[model samples]
Target: MSLIAWSLPKKTQLPAVSLLGNLFVLWFAPYAFVAMSISACLVYLISHAKSQKGHWVLLGVGYCISQFLLLRFLQEHSVDLGLGGSFSVLGVAYFTCRDVHYLVESYKGNVRKNIVTFWYYQSFLPVMIAGPINRYHEFEREIQRRSLDFDQISKGIERIIYGYAKVTVLGNYLIEHKIQSYLTQLPNQESILHSWLVSLADWAYLYAQFSGWSDVAIGFSLCIGIKVSENFNRPLSSKSLVDFWKRWHISLSSWCKDYVFTPALLITRNLFIAISLSMVTMGLWHESSLYYIFWGIYHAIGITLCRLYMKQDNEIVEYLRQRFWWSSFTRALTIFYLINASVFIGLFYDGLY
Candidate 1:
């Protein structure tokens, strides 16, 4: 797919190729294609609408409807409003984000009014499933100036290799097969050490699995001369809960910051409320469940506390901040907090008490 896109005769034809490729991929999941097509049409029409007093309201309504459908599809597993077949749209969460991003950017006069380009952005195959959520402007620019080069291909292949190793070896083999199996066979699964180990393993497995796929998506994009946004950046090594969010799932976090947090902050003028709303939105983006809601709130509280602590002017705090080992200590502390939180959430959801 990368080769085909890269080898296209005219750069102007890139969007058409991308659109066709995405449609081809979606053909396997016809219902998803239909759903996404409808969304694309709506977004295009909204983008082309005249600037009016109710423009923002229209965008809000469309966004809310899309999110509602995402949550409903997640809960019900199908459209099922007399749509004959019982099939749900695949990658609904991702494509919805893409559409909303396009709509918002279009409103801001940042995107072209080309429907083909819009559809290409919405259905780009590499980031279609697990995305770094490439912005439409960046994608359009890349499509125009893409090249078939050796160095880029080699780097792309290397990234893909690293991603596969992380997914298969670290996530599947080391964690799933070895560590989890050993834990399962433990005599005292309720021990503190056991719990901590489980938490660490689970966290590692999730990072490996998610970052691995992101790496693959990035590699594929790079192969075609389009550099998408990165998804992760050593999140476990972050110095605080606040810092962790800046590194982990960076695309989504940044998106929420721009689209949710900033807007809420502007409206409410309250730091805690903004952070809480943003985190909850991020959490619900993964799944519309109480577990994820609490997961988001847990992190939001931690982040708020971290932010508060950073504002402290105490001498002891200053002394600690100036120490060489302070960063290492804080990094470890952050990882510990995240691990325990994950464990607690897992236990709560699984009723393991």
Candidate 2:
């Protein structure tokens, strides 16, 4: 294979790392990760995939495939895997395509400038993974996005450190001490609360792992040259389950709202029917799994109830807000309710398989 030396001004370029840098940080072997990233990126490019949801599904599948090949088929000698190496393959492939999508949106009217500058911004690595799901129009403004200012830097570092501490300390304790033992021990079918208590640790562990990484990514983006979208908020603070969803995985919620819910709602005047269809769409979108269906149903019921409850006389939402002051007691109660409900739903349906 021939490699070409790229020449571009640092000012004009989107902030991303080199192939060699990707190799160093992101793959089982630099070569292997590079190959996987190339293949995955090619897959999206050739497919001309438009939606972020599609990209996420494809990336998840690609990661699974690469892991199977590297860990199952190939020996350790065949590849030395680092977390970034595997993550990079999935991450780079995703962001590369998203940047392209955003650029296309950015240059809706100017075809000439759009084509010329498309590749430059698209290949920038910062926005490529765990994205804000850019629309090309907005990205035109940030073509040569710069590093954070002092205030941004300070806040970003604090957020990153907080994220790291959450994952490393609290998240680690749950995983290493609680989750492991619980997973090995068979569920006591007699008392559901036993299962609920154990699984809550797993959920917290998952949140810490993912949120911690997301914070680090956000901090890294600021340290470099671009500001990406926020991923999560304090979801458990939600008054209702629907509100909880809005706070929790913002990207996925938005995707579902935009692509599935709104479209379905538009098609029919019947609220129940629209919701029913929306939930089914969400289930299939999550991958055609039984568990996803259950989750979708759970969400549909929750959303529907929330809507219906709001329409009733003396709305529960207004009552709750007016009744309870936002205090540690209320917040803890909200957390308790959400976690307890989620635990049963989670165990009742573990994996798609």
Candidate 3:
């Protein structure tokens, strides 16, 4: 797909290429294509609505209903739908977010209403499945400025190779096969050490898997002369939960911050409520289950505590901040907090005694 896009002479042909590629990919799952098309049309119409406030409410309700139905279907059927198991439910989670972003930005008068550009943004093959959730404006700008550059193509190829290595070698072989297998074989599976090990391995595998897909998406976009936002940045090295969110799944976090947190904060005028709503929304976006809700709440509590701690004016805090080892200590503490939180949740879901 990237090669085909790169070979096109006219920049105007880019969206067409994307459409073709998207159609081909969606051919096996026509329902997804139809659903996404309807969503795109609705967003377009809502963008041009007379009352911005009413349209915004409608968009919110529609988004929630659609997501709920999609998730319910996914959970009930566990349908692969096609794409050779590369994605389930045909990337509805991702493209739906993109559509909402467009609708919101359109409401804010930031995006121009062009169906072609909006469709292109929704179905762009590179970031279609696993996304950095490229914004419409950024994508349009890239489309306008794109050109076939050899250097960019070479770097893109390198990134793709690195991404596949992370997915297959690090995520699949080393972590899932070797480390997880060894951990599972331990004599005491319920031991603290075993749980922690399992959690750590799970976290590592998730990062490699997600970041690897992001890398591939970004690489493919680069190959087609478009640069997308990055999704991860050494999240495990973060010194606090707040810092970790800033570094982890950056696009989604920022989206939630902008769309969910800010709006909830303004409407409710409460910090805890806003943060909890945002985090829970993000968690539910991953999977609509009790486990994810608790996961979100756990992070919300961590973030709230971090914020409160930052508001303190104590000498001990100042002294710790000045220490050279403080950063390392906090980094380790943050990672430990996250791993154990996951372990706890896993145990709870698995019926802890």
Candidate 4:
């Protein structure tokens, strides 16, 4: 009698482990997990229906409308679905964006015939929460060359450590100290310096929390031999609000530029209308609320003005640019605008006013 032994390939091991991690994440967040599974299945089914042109696009739009309405219903009823009263779908926002990308590309006959690969690409746990949204073409290419070199592993580990430090140390410290609460009370105290301090703290805290999460996600994907796109790139140091957007949440911005902005511009043949459509879609994608619409409009105005300024051919503007303090002044102004505009992100129903 003989006992049989089985072993997995070196390259297959990371994805297998990742699948286990995905299972654990699902176990922890059952509601979000179920929602994700259903969405994945829907995309999978729709992918096979080549005869029906643009069906997946219709599905994507329908899903967005449904999610928006669900959010509104939940808000109106004061209901907590899951995960701190947010949408029960953990990565629905990211998931939908990916689905749209896949569908559009597939519709153009760019995708391959690999269901398992597509499944892993969609439900990969690292980016299931917040995303540096991955594209199927790049993901598939990476999967083919997956390896665990010492250098890659070390870089991945370093990213994870740095990201963990940012989130657990700096971000938590700011929150524990009640940065927002302090900002709220500064008006009553009438302390201008205190208000500035709290505002700066809030800004730093937001960057740490978001960029930290992105780092961790990208690091994990790297460990698994996939290089997810970078989400943040020293956005705080941006010279202009328009430059800030180009460096911040880069994957989402790229997606908007490629899928939404380009096509909208082509159809409308107007810069302002295209910018409005792209910005509003991006804003609403974050959360379904009138506040987000306003936030989108606010940024649209800022970006448009920046573009206009850059396009202007004025001697006064040229002279100002030559001044030693000009760049510093512009940077300072950009940061001030960012903080003021970002306050709208926290506003909801009553807070909207």
Candidate 5:
């Protein structure tokens, strides 16, 4: 069935088939259906509202509330706040992003308003769970331009294989098992190498897991004749923290830049505060905890410092460049800083501290 679908060029068949398959999977949790339905309805209303500015504000507030509730649920694990009993909304966080994109674009009169297309874009099963969060405009364009070319199909297949390998092999083995075990013994072992090893493994593990999910989502989207966003591109090779974010989680980072950072910067007229707020929002999106909060603040400071450093005079930059090992040294330092930060995130996630 999958092989035949891969070979076929019928655009309509894929959505029908994919939608039905996702519906079947969604049936396992009826509450998820209700949640998505409610979310979709709200999004539709926001998209079509007469007072779009007010509606957008209302939608934004609702979005934050939903995230807070979900975060609370994840933390407590046994609390019920009426959306669903003690279960995370399957794709609530991702959908919130899509919802925000739809609302903001529609309000700005930038997106063509189509109820049918909006529903399809919002609920597209492949990218729903873990997204390279597709924009409505881009998604619509891809759908219009979709073709079942051999190159696209082959690329999709290769991405799927690579993504599967990343998740199952590198993520599962190197980090989840081996490195995880090593970290658990770090305190007792009392070795700097062990600490560094844990941090390094965690940084790699996070990239492998999240980027693997992104690859799988992108690969499936491509197979179905859509070109969703790419989420990562050699983030570890980044020369600076600012550049690292540009390459990592491309979807979310771009989303925040467009929807949060830019607007906040305009409103507050303060780059530092705007950048800090963006980082904080990104961190909280992961989970609501002191650890995640600190993670966000930490990145914000890193980025702010980088920005300040770059503002130095041209002479200073030229002098620094004169040193033969300056480039290599800076690159290694950036990686080291990221790894150091990620160690805390890993420990937090694993409940090690």
Candidate 6:
């Protein structure tokens, strides 16, 4: 930690503080949630939440209920009926719902895509924190016929090392300077400048913090008999919001697009209502905060605008691509910008409630 900070000039080291602060947060945030999750797990064992997806659902619902009870005993109220605990419950529930819906869609036929067992799925430890959020089908084929070449091994290890460095080293600054008591002293209503800075740090923190874990998970899975999906691509290298979505936190975005956006759109051609409702639903899923709700609408509005505007010109993306300088520049800035916005959205993650 000191070595990397020493490499940078003195002034640049402030972010280092925020990174470190976030590291501590990451380290300690899960104890309460994990205990609740385990209790949920036991309930699942005793009850009949039999399928892998079913286990996730039961676990999620039970965990939330358990958390509610605990908080209530402490004389605290839930932020919503479902929040003030790990966000993973929502994620697990969503995946379970997706799995069940998929099975129903397939009419109980050959719906077996990912053959990896539930034990392999949930028991994998890395994803329990932040997530790449893999789908069940992603593992279906690979688990059945998995192999790693020499190149794969080398690359995987590199990814893991890089990821750890990102979280521990890069994320250190964000945690130390930002996530700790420093930011809490600031007013909630921040200026555009502070918001923007927070935005950048937030993204950097998430990247180093999350992708770092993801890389470790993916690499470890590669080492073991199990394998998992990649969560991020060169997301910061996206040219536009659409491209950014395509690259960043792919599993969550794709799941949202598939289950939320498409279904909402198909239900009606009313773009405004459909998109707004979808974003609101997405918001509620995360932590049921007004901030997240607004955050959802904000992105949905921006994305919808991008989609509408893009359709206006036949040569927009193609033209941008040919103008290599513009494309690359935009992509780079955008990656930072989107993550920055993400951080602002994540403001609520600071345990405000």
RMSD (Å) per prediction: 2.6, 7.9, 2.8, 4.8, 3.4, 11.5
In candidate 4, the residue pairs with backbone N, CA or C atoms under 3 Å apart (3 or more residues apart, or in different chains) clash, namely none
Report, for every candidate in turn, its global Cα lDDT versus the true structure.
0.80, 0.54, 0.82, 0.74, 0.77, 0.56
TM-score of 5: 0.88
Best by TM-score: 3
Which sequence of candidate numbers ranks them by lDDT, best first? 3, 1, 5, 4, 6, 2
**Among all candidates shown, the one with the greatest lDDT:** 3
Task: Give the Å shift of residue 63 in candidate 6.
Answer: 12
For residues 113-176, what per-residue lDDT tens digits would candidate 5 score against the true structure?
7876776786688788886888889988887886667788779879988998899899998789
lDDT of 6 by residue, 74-139 (tens): 333333435355432323433343343343333333344322244344433444445566655565
Q: Write down the lDDT that model 6 would get.
A: 0.56
Q: Which residue pairs in candidate 3 have backbone atoms (N, alpha carbon, C) closer than 3 angstroms, thus clashing?
A: none
lDDT of 5: 0.77
Q: Which stretches of candidate 1 lie over 4 Å from their true place?
A: 11-16, 52-88, 346-353
Model 3 poorest 10 in a row by lDDT: 80-89
Better of 2 and 6 by lDDT: 6
Q: How high is the lDDT of residue 334 in model 6?
A: 64
> Over the full model, what C-alpha lDDT does candidate 4 score relative to the true structure?
0.74
TM-score of model 4 vs. true structure: 0.85
State in Å the error of residue 74, model 6.
Answer: 11
Pairs that clash in candidate 5: none
TM-score to native of every candidate shown: 0.91, 0.64, 0.92, 0.85, 0.88, 0.63
Where is model 5 poorest over a 10-residue stretch in terms of lDDT? 1-10
The deviation in Å at residue 333 for candidate 2 is 7.6
Off-target runs (Cα >4 Å) in candidate 6 are: 1-110, 113-116, 147-154, 174-191, 314-353
